[model samples]
Every structure is written in structure tokens, then in C-alpha cells.
Target: MTDFVDNVAFIGLGAMGYAMAKNIRKKMAPTGTLYVFDVFGRVCEKFRDEFKSFGPIVIVESPKEAAAMSQTIISIVPGAKEVRDVYLNNNSGVIVAPKNEDRLIMECSTIDSQSSREVGQALGTAGTGKYIDTPVSTRMQGGVPGADSGTLSFLIGHSKPSDTDPISHRLEKVATMMGNPKKFFYCGKLGAGLAAKISNNYLSCSILLAVAEAMAIGIRSGVDEKLLHEVIQNSTGQNFMADVVQPVPGVVPDAPSSNNYRLGFKTQMMIKDLGLGVDAGYATGIKPTMAEAAYRVYENAAVDPKCIDRDGSSVYLHITTTQEDHQE
Candidate 1:
């Protein structure tokens, strides 16, 4: 174990985090240590075995251990509750770690803006670290593949929005370790990252449902599925979901639709994120008509056994089979 200057820590070894951490470890200096933590011990072990050759990968027991030892901490957990647990759970959370002003904490989950603010406030008061919300996104429906390929975009919410701020430069330097440099957006103050993300997802999920419904109508009207999709792709109706992540099977050969709608963002999680957008809309006194409608469809689809654990686009299958549609 050689002494290194840029020791960094990453938490959450789930689908997105695993790939993000893998890229971080691969891009890290040979001597720098990459500390990782996850609630599942097996995931940590697997990550170490798989990526240790890229750099020194240290598997720690808790967020405290990871934060205590690293100059920068990046986390992308499941949801708000898990986010609070990893950062606020007194005994083991990162909040209890030694106070280190130089330590920069970046959370990359697409949780509610409120939770991001809560953790940011707690970190500020505790003086453990500086907290920034950095929720991940990508062009089109590039989910896991975006993380794996290191082309993902990050929405950053830092205290200093100025491009010349030393802290902002530092944020980008570390963020580009797992994201595209040109694709980074410093979306304003803390909580703004999630605000941007929730808004993006609100539109993305709505488009997903719209695409699903349009495809259903076309197919039911005797238009060939792939042909209808191709027409839409070349016509005015095309969008990312239509061209890149077509929900219709055989339209996109490698999409989740072709793979039984598995290994993508789950329908239940889509509902949760949509609900976040809907709640934000109400809180801001703006009616999110399309988001609310999409939310209802996803909520009902999530309860169906066939679509519950499938990809969010599985709503296509649900709509075609269930005979329920949202309309004028």
C-alpha cells in the first residue's frame, strides 16, 4: 500500500454505482486508493475482485469509514431513505466522520430535492464536508450503458455556480472521472441538481408513456410495428424513446424491449421518480398535467405482476395487454 495524494471513496455498488466506481478506479492513479462501500457485503467483495487490478480498491464497512479516509466521496444510493441512512445515521453515517473541510462529498442519486437539501444542511452544520447534489443523466435512454461507457451527463448543484470558482473547478475535475467533461452542467445551488434531474425525468417519463401509447395505437390499427417505428423515427413524431429506446420489440434490436424489458430502470422506480416531479410541481404551485397523468398510468402499471419489475418502457406491454389508456 503506497502513500498516494488523491485517495477517493465511493458508496453504493448497485447497477449505476458499480459502473461509475469501476470507471473511477480505472481512471485513478496507480498509487491512489479507491475506497468503496455498500450495504451488501457481497457486492463490495465482487467489486474488489473485479476492479482491484485497475487501482487499489479498499472495501470499507460503512460510509463513515469511506468518508474518514478519502478526500472526496461520491455516492449514488437507491432513494431518499437510503440517502439519509448513509449520510445521517449517527453512528455509521458520513456525518459522523472526522471534520475535513477539504473533503468534498458528492451525492449522485435522483432522489427528491428536499432530501438533498436536508443532507447538505446537515453536512454544513456538522462541518464534516461540503455536500453537492450530482444526479446523473444521459442523452436518450442511455441508462446503465451510459455509466458503463463513461458518457453519462451529470447535473451538478454546487454552492458556487461561478465557472471560475476554485470549488466548482474541483467539482468538475472529480466529476469527470466518471462523467463526460463537456456534458457536465453546474445547475445552480444545492438542490438544483435534483431540481433539474426531476424536471428532466418528468418530461422523459411522460414521453415514454406517450411513445408507448402511440405505438400501441399504430400497431392496433394494422401498421407494422417496426415499420411504424421507422416512420415515426423519420417523421415529426420521433423522439429519444422512439429512435433510441423503442418500446416496441424488434424495433431496437438491443433495447430493453428486445430483452423482455429487463435490466433497465424499473417501473416501480419510475413511479417513484414521477411522484417526485409531481410533488415538486404541487409544492411550486404549478400543475404538472402530463406528469400527473403519466404518474397515474405508471402507478397502475407498477401494480401489475407483469410490469412491476420490468423496465419503465414495459408500460407498452402493459397498455397493449391491460386495455387501459389515458386520453382526452
Candidate 2:
């Protein structure tokens, strides 16, 4: 691979984006220039000030400016539409056509495979820059400590194997700066990363829903929620959900689930991802009953003010509370 580039531009400074950008600033030593842009002026200014001590923090007006100023452009926008608007929409005057063939564009949004392919095609045809779909699997909290430790797992979709090597190496450095770089898989093709992210998240959401249902049943049957969680933890269900955060209340006392579900992964975001998963499944004519059901539950919860304030783990509270309130 070629020598790692120093200057980088980051678009979208949302919770996760801000953390990733901050980690990049910390790890890329000699302190390379970092240009950032977001719809919120305050976020841009905040990050600019926070990272100013580390290196040069340029606050730009738009995505195009950020793309134009750096050798590599990274996007961590919310959804497929935002990703398209920031990178591919020519009408917005924010499309950053690459200055040379060496430039790289990495998108870390969790969207669908189709959207990823379309965006990748457009960016690739722009001729100067190569695009890579590198959606992350870690949670928002993971962003803070995860960035510095380089423990975030990345599933990458690249135009070609050769085009990916340098970007992967650079991202590993960036990931480790944030936390510990665990797994970086080159999944192949332009949309593979998006597909992998959605598939993984669908399972996560499903498991959380299952855990919520199980806990609700146990609580209704006079079984303690903590005991049920312990059994599940010792069982095969002890994946990320059991180890990191449980969806049921009283399972993990320190988890967001026990704290009324405030500030983790928002229910609105989970609903959006479930929608994407449903759409993907429908397109393939595969029945995703569990995923579709979970999507509806999150969708219903998103409208509730309490659930809206909490993370996806709050689904357990919704199930348990509703069941208790409705019980005879």
C-alpha cells in the first residue's frame, strides 16, 4: 500500500461521527490537518474547538468544502437519503469530485445494499476518487472509548481489492486510535458492507426484542427479571446483547435498560434500520417475520415520548410496563 495520507475531511459530526473524527485526530500523529462539516453550526464549532488542541481543525460551510480540502473524505451521516445528498447530489453544489485518482471516500452509514451500490457507482464514475462502504457495528457509547482504543469492527465494501488495501490500513490506524481494531473484513463488492451491517443489526434488534418478550413473560409469571437475564447470559444468548447491554430491565443494573433507556441507541434509529432490513428482505422475497415484527414494535415505541427519549433497549420497559398495566 502507498504511504498513509495525512489530511482528512470528515462530514457529519453527529454523536458517532464526532467520536470517530476525534479519534482520527488523536491517532494520525504529527497532527494532520482535519477539516469537518455538519448541518449544525454548533457541532462544527464545538469539534473545531475540542480538537484544535490536537491539530488544525478547519470548520467548513458544506460537505463539498470538506471534501475539497482533504485527501480522504469520510461520511457518517444518518440514513441513505442523507448519504446521497451529501455525496452524490450535484444540485446541492456539495458533490466533491476527486482531484486525482488517489483520493478516497469512505461512508460509514448503516443503509441498504442498493443505496451503497448506487452511491459507490456515482463516486467511482467521478474518476478521481475511490469509494468504500465501511459501515461500523459498534454502539454510540463505543464511539467515545472505542475510537481511542481501536476496537471498532468494520465491514468494508470496496470497488476492488487493490483499492481497499490502503484505505483499510489507514482505517485500522484510525480505529486503533479510537479503541482496539478488532475485525476489519473486506466483504467484497460495493454494497456488501451495507448488507452485512443491516443483517447484523437485524439480528441484534431481533435478539433484543426476544429478550424483552422473555423478560416480560418472566416478570408476569413472578420470575425476577435479573434471574432470567442471568440464565440467558449463561446460555447461548450471551452474544453482544448479553455481554455489552441487555434489553430487559434489572438484567444488567448499570445498563441503559435499567436506567429508563435514556441515551444509548435511540428507538427511532432502530426503527429506521428495521425498516431498511424489511425493505431489503422484501426485495429478495425472503420472509423476515421476526425482523418485521421487531420493526413494528420499535416503530410503535418511537412515537411514545418516554421510549423516544430512551435507547432501543427501552423496548423491554415498553413490553413489561404495558403488560403489567393491561393485566387483570
In terms of lDDT, the best-performing candidate is 1
Provide the TM-score for each candidate, comma-separated: 0.91, 0.89
Best by TM-score: 1
lDDT of 1 by residue, 1-328 (tens): 2222368899998899999999889888878899999989999999999988887899898999998898889999989999999999999999999997667888999898988999999988999888999999844424688899888888888654456665566677777777787877777789999999899999889999999999999998999998998899889998887886688888898778888886578888888888999999998999999998998999888998878878888989888887844442
User: Compared with the true structure, what per-residue lDDT tens digits does model 2 show for residues 83-119?
Assistant: 9898777754235554555667788888888988887
What do the candidate models score in CA lDDT, each in turn? Answer: 0.86, 0.74
Worst 10 residues of 1 by lDDT: 1-10
lDDT of 2 at 67: 67
Local error of candidate 2 at residue 22 (angstroms): 0.9
lDDT of 2 at 108: 87
Please list the residue runs of candidate 2 whose C-alpha ends up more than 4 Å from where it truly belongs after superposition.
1-4, 91-98, 140-150, 159-168, 236-239
Clashes of 2: 18
Per-residue error (Å), model 1, residue 238: 2.6
